[model samples]
Target: MNYTYYGMFLWLPSVLSEKGYSLVHSLGYVLVMTLAQVPGYLTAAWLVERWGRKKTLVTAMILAAVAALLFGLANSTAMLIVCGLFLSYFMLAAFAGTYIFTVEQFPTVARATGMGWAAGFGRIGSALAPFITGWLLGVHLGYGWIFGLFFAILLVGFVIVVTLGYETRGKDIH
Candidate 1:
């Protein structure tokens, strides 16, 4: 899941370039993406307290799907940038919430280990995403199709979280 989230950012620049955008445009798009995540981090902190971890994660996944789809459909560079911002926002929210959720799911003795493993596995996904995106791009799949694939992956993540995830609201961490 974390892998998929990080994968989106990994391939974002390549996707932009495939669309005929310059390096400056890609960098600016990245800035927009990063800036959009700030609010999500704060919102995740609050939403986890108010609604609980499960709901927050589920909601973030849904938003990720919407953002991903919009990103794939965006016709212009500006529209793509806007979708990128929205994608970053929800992805960050989901990412942070998962950390909190994972930690809460384990006992103290193994909590750190579990969280570490989860994070590590997510990084593997992140690592693979760039390669996959590059391969697809090399084959001339186009930015729109690449983003469409991302949206599909995010949708799967949402379903996984909703079906297999647990509620961890008001639980003692220790």
Candidate 2:
């Protein structure tokens, strides 16, 4: 979702215009969201160490999903920007945690390979997401459906991480 959102939001100004927002409004939300991401990255780095990887990952994932949903449902500009800020924060935090967790999941033998595969998969999604998102929005299904899809996708990722993940905060990577 992090990567997808990066691509998806590149056209955010237009997307918001579709929802009856001005270009200035769209820029405001995107700008604030960008600023919000910094704290998420910093806090995730701290939480991954203090709270452990799995916990931080799951929490951020959940927050991201909720925020995406809210962003989709928002009727007003203020609500939209607020929700987007939160969505950006948690999504970036999840991204950071995912990176650390993916690295920790592999042993020395295939650490590089595992990291490469994981990032490659993310890139593929990022590459494909714009088309899919454009289609979803093009259908005029509204922000609710488009953002709902994002919410569901993030939830699926959350489930996969939780189901397949193990706690690795203190474990020595060899």
Give per-model CA RMSD: 1.9, 1.3
Q: Write the per-residue lDDT of candidate 2 for residues 12-95, one digit (tens) a residue.
A: 777888887778877876888789899998999999999999999999998999998898899887888899889889988998
Give each model's clash number: 0, 0
Q: List lDDT for all candidates, in order.
A: 0.80, 0.85
lDDT of 1 by residue, 46-146 (tens): 89989899898888878887888788788987888788888888888987788787788788999889889877877888888878877877898666687
Task: Give the local distance difference test score of model 2.
Answer: 0.85
Stretches of model 2 off by over 4 angstroms after superposition: none
- State TM-scores per candidate: 0.88, 0.95
At residue 96, candidate 2 shows an lDDT of 85
Model 1 TM: 0.88
